[model samples]
Target: MGLGWIRRRTGHRAAKNQPGDLDMEALIPDHFLCPISLDLMKDPVTLSSGITYDRQSIDTWLEGGNFTCPVTNQVLRSFDQIPNHSLRKMIQEWCTENKRYGIERVPTPRVPVMPNEVSEILFSLAGSARNLDHQGCFECVRRIKNWAAESERNKRCILENGAASVLSAAFDSFAGDCGKKNAIVCEELLSALSWMLPAFDEESHKYLGSKASLHCMVWFLKETDDLSVKQNSLLALKQLLSCDDHTKHAEALAEIGGVNDILFKLIREKISPAITKASLMVVFYLISSSSSAGEKIKLSFLEMGLVSVLLEMLVDSERGVSERALAVIDSLCDCDEGREKAYADALTIPVLVKKILRISEMATEHSISAIWKLCKCASRQEERVLVEALQVGTFQKLLLVLQVRCGDDHTKEKTNELLKLLNPYRAGLECIESVDFKSIRRSF
Candidate 1:
């Protein structure tokens, strides 16, 4: 009675006054609150246990791998959430009645997508792909992409119902003919696939790992001028390269003409951090796959001025790009030509020295490994390289690295060996400083 009397008085005054004049705290009923979030349910949905929760709250619960109702703790028979239209309408009406208290009415919620709806979309796409119906496939994929963009629930439903295989097949079919219409459809398909990237299963990977699929992605990377299309293509290729039979895929990618050059171009352009990182990772995978393919790709990358491009990226303040650049550099230095190219670059020694113990543990390890390779393989300019290492604080960083045990045992051994190599030059710094390190270049 006391609360009711107060609310009546306040509501009367609020009706005559403007919004926010009356405090609505303690006025909202308990039944209007969602069980999980304890907030007003805008889009109320009822679970199988006859409990109502906000759609977003229940979705988050289910998506987090929980299988039971939050309050009852009973295992859910199905993930389907029935919309509580009556409760939502009540909440909306309450909000409208209390408009003077600054309450905003929630809009009518869209019907949630179901698994069967997703299956229907996929069926249409498969039919279009099978018949090579470009227009039909385009319409179907556009619908799927729109749904995917709507909600996480829709994406989960779309992927769970087998969107990947259908999209891959459609992409492959459209990719065969690179005409204007087909390119448009392929771009749309890539846009849709980007949403489900790196979440593909083994079956999906099989479709994406095919030789024709690999070539199609490479084509997008090379020929497409659109930034987003290129980015999505890189994302797809990265996921494909991470599959079980990635080495075989890597070999196939290496055989593609000008693939290394295209990757280098993307890195050099500095288009965006994400694109740059994905491109670098793709390069890493290609060059680190199998011995034969890795060597071939590494040599190709080295010839395309890979050292210069990586050195440029190493100076970037972005830790991810810097770390990846160091890693690729380490791999590149495994070969004789790679080391020679690195030594030829004036920025190589100083950059490596600057990154050691400064970026990250992994970065420091890569920097040290690259330095070891350069100095260890220096036949003509061995003393000069060692002197440069000492002059740039490499000796001190190596000592500190050992003190901290920054990397694995192999890295530690390399650090120790590097320290040993640079230790002798410490006392001879005075005489070593007399020579011009920049002018001393080895004949490649």
Candidate 2:
């Protein structure tokens, strides 16, 4: 039979049979299949637009720059994927019945940790840690960490229930001991604490203030060969460094034993993008915090060739990554050493100029600010830099910025300052003009 004819006949038969369709092959309901993949959904997740699809398919769709419902074409308010647990159970049940037809049964999915469960775990952990119940605390910390690792929501719960205080106290009790048991327990607690640090801000001061917690996290970053543990430690340390109010914490982060070296190695090795980005953020916070310590941190990053790393990241296709990379560059360029390093890279000026209108407004703000810093702080040794900017069509890009209103007031002000600076350097008092301005304006 022709495939089209068969499909039409089957549709008629299906409509006639309705819910009574009992043929084994066609028994699988239409709703069981993902709209995108046309297969039984192993893990169904519902979109904000009220459409359901297999998790892998929907993740692929969203990752492919889609933000609308596939079935309804409605605009989505959020990208959050909610698990359709009831649909998943039905699909699994159907798969089980069709095993004779060679259909494999879907495995049960892991249940995300609930907030109440996390609260129970946190309460037990706090009570155990307080009563010096090392074994009890160890078990509780392990459970809490597993829960936090399972979901972002659970991580927030872990933080809100005083996980930080509990973990810090546990680490302090065990940090001084050199036995294998103590070290193992502390490592477990530190791993758990790291996952909660990003969301929980209540214990930032207390947790970071503890010498034991700092030492343990630093030790984990420096001594551990496991990338997962290192990634967690980096995240925990980043929160501490970012949230600490005292200059001592900032200075400690900047001068911590092997901190910069480890960060440099991670960035240079490109182990994992997540790890590198976390390390970069830690360095950014460390450098951007204290004015007295800023120069030292800036010099540290410059010496580590961060300018080259950041310039490369600007070309990344992902806008979020590019935006963050630019933010670090902006922080680094606040000092003369950093500005000189940035200007020295051959790609720096052109990349900054190109990204002005192409990236997000925040990115544009940082790019313009970095360029202005370079131009505003230009020295006698780098007089040709301005000429280079003009030669590379920086003036045309700035004019485009002025015309398009691609960003906020800060962006406009920076562009104006850069143009004012360049005006003086223009040859023969001539106003720079671009032939494509009219077309470019229309596109913008």
Candidate 3:
């Protein structure tokens, strides 16, 4: 919104669209599309004349703040008053179609799938000046969603056949289309699938759980990174974990591995805490979703020695990595016996100790939850080791954490019981104080 935020457009269109970026045709419609404004819509600023759209004026009028339009020298006080009728029409249309989807969810008859040409037309329309027409924009969004749903069903088949061009185009178009842009669609899709799953005929399973489609699910889970997307993807994957759908979990995990270089950059380099939280959840999915995935996450964790870095981040004045670390540890706790043994043999103490230490630094409920989980997992043998490890300062760290972070009375009670074991304690005192006197009576 600020003039300073705008840069004089530089690179050639070819450079901008080289392989990894949004394509021009996919970005917006060519006709009536202003070359200078890109996706924001072109100038004169207002849909009509006389009282023109003023970016800073709108911003100031709203009294939120002020901003200048990038193209026209106009003031905008808020996005609400930017008189773009076409954009409004598109948005209204989108909202209406959304309602239709809601109605269908409530028990409407199934609509016939729209023709492929209609989908192409809708994709093109979304790119054009027609994109500003409220009704037209909304229709464009509707067509995009329907097409995405159909394409998603087809994605796995295409992937298995190795139809790279078709798959890539579908992936790009789906990401560019706003109807498919947010997490809501995935959430709805997974929710509907849950009802249908129990009664799924093999044909339905073949389509929905196809190796290609399952891979796409992983792709969406890892690539999208929106919070809602992250949460729903985990839910869908959790559902899949219980079914035969996870026969491909290892392959899905491998496809996900292709993207960890990006995550490594995100972890070591700067990333916003919100994005970091989702990143950690996705990582947890990678590990906890299957034993094979657990192997992959463990290897990556060791390669990165993420625990040390996460600890350093735990002490960060601004942000910390305690949640992510806890997730990794949780996955380790569940892995198959061989892998679990490797974890206990190699990592159990170091990772848990670091997380316990971090509990003191974090003010969030999440950190406390992580410590409680660690307490639940430690064997009495591991507990003794942990107690020995704590001799330098560990018990105090957990005590301070419990003082603030304990979420429930039961967790606090568990903590007290564990502490009494670790301390210099009278052995019979714990049994005497037990909720059941059976242990004390047996002792007697």
Candidate 4:
């Protein structure tokens, strides 16, 4: 008797808490609605006073300077100050859906919640992150991580079904007051990204045959420009490359493009070293993973000195950012024809070679790989510099590195091939010996 009553009460409460799917319409207004009698908003027109009112006579009234509010004939003047909470939620849903499936009807989480309502929910929920008991924080994340590792079904169910709640939980833990930034948010965001990665033959879909995880991503990205969020964004792009859907990958790429703006906004007031570093790293990963997304990224990079910006990242003390910046160079040279020319026509090759040689000297594997890829796309003079640098002692470190991880016979052969291309002269000779050169050659 007790269990039945509890279940009935819970069911009733759940039904009450979540409105029916059609309830979003009530959040809209009749007088504010578009003048077109019977349709949902598609292209909402604007007033001259900068009022972006809906369902009003915008077209008829645009002829004269004296504009009256559509609803109450109020005076109009500034478009910038207009605030439409319903429109925001509608567009928010629009962009989120466009991110996943193709264009579709905008979703309203619970139709007609005012803009203040969303703000309140987000702020209040975000504030909860401040209160995660130390032990509770660790245990919750541990459980999530363990679920991620246990089974594919488990991973997908948690990520796809509970992504919102999980993020809400993550947000609560994100408060700086707790101090477990890396594991709580940064590392977890990076790790959760692997789930969204589409398999070779599978495209991701939610239980409804759609995806909302992106909404969760946008929330985090917009909520905090923290290094963890930026890092997670980068890691997510890196994994997104595995997705066969170019359109989806392109959409994800767009967010990275916005990062440049995010960085400059910081620079406008006061520069942040961590932000600068994270920003460059994200650019690098994005460009590398989405080589084909050329036109979309070109303007942002050029407007932002995308090349020089990355060159600066090399000097950043955070090795991770510097490494990712190197990655950006490799990716750009591969995709953007203009960038390849910029290296030659702009006379940047010597600088690139110098950086490569220095990175090789420092034993930075990521830099070496990036530098090597760039080497493939350089002109003869750049090759000369690379060859000369190798002759002076760069090759020893590279050879040693070759023995470590990328040392298989194929990579070694490729390296040798590149070396010969860089310099046809006798300096390319393997004059030094004793490390199984012939044996390695034989394997090749």
Instruction: Give the per-residue lDDT of model 4 (tens digit) for 1-444.
Output: 111100111234434664342122222333334543323344354555444543223433443454566555677664322335667566556445432222245433222223343344334433444564444544444555565565443454454443444443443245233233433443453355444443312323221111233334434454554655654544444444434454455455465435446544432322356555445544554444444454556556655666665564454334445455555665566554635544543323433433432433232433444445556665665555455444444455456545654444544664566555545543553333233233332220
lDDT of 4: 0.44
Model 3 regions lying over 4 Å from their true place: 1-251, 255-257, 260-262, 271-274, 317-321, 333-405, 424-444
Worst 10 residues of 2 by lDDT: 1-10
lDDT of 3 by residue, 217-276 (tens): 556555665555544444444444445655455345456445555544555553556445
Give the root-mean-square deviation of each candidate in angstroms: 6.8, 9.6, 19.0, 22.1
- Name the weakest run of 10 consecutive residues (lDDT summed) in model 1: 1-10
TM-score order, best first, reads: 1, 2, 4, 3
Q: Report the lDDT tens digits of candidate 1 across residue range 333-440.
A: 888989889878889988998887666788888999999988888886556888888877777667767766688998998998898887888875523222323322
Q: Name the better of 1 and 3 by TM-score.
A: 1
**Alpha-carbon error at 311 in model 4, in Å?**
2.3
- Provide the TM-score for each candidate, comma-separated: 0.85, 0.67, 0.37, 0.40
Ranked by lDDT, top first: 1, 2, 4, 3
Predicted model with the maximum lDDT? 1
In model 1, the runs with Cα more than 4 Å from the true position are 1-26, 63-67, 74-79, 97-104, 179-181, 402-405, 408-410, 428-444
RMSD of 3: 19.0
Task: Report lDDT (CA) for all predictions.
Answer: 0.81, 0.73, 0.42, 0.44
Off by over 4 Å in 2: 1-120, 127-134, 146-160, 175-183, 244-246, 312-318, 426-444
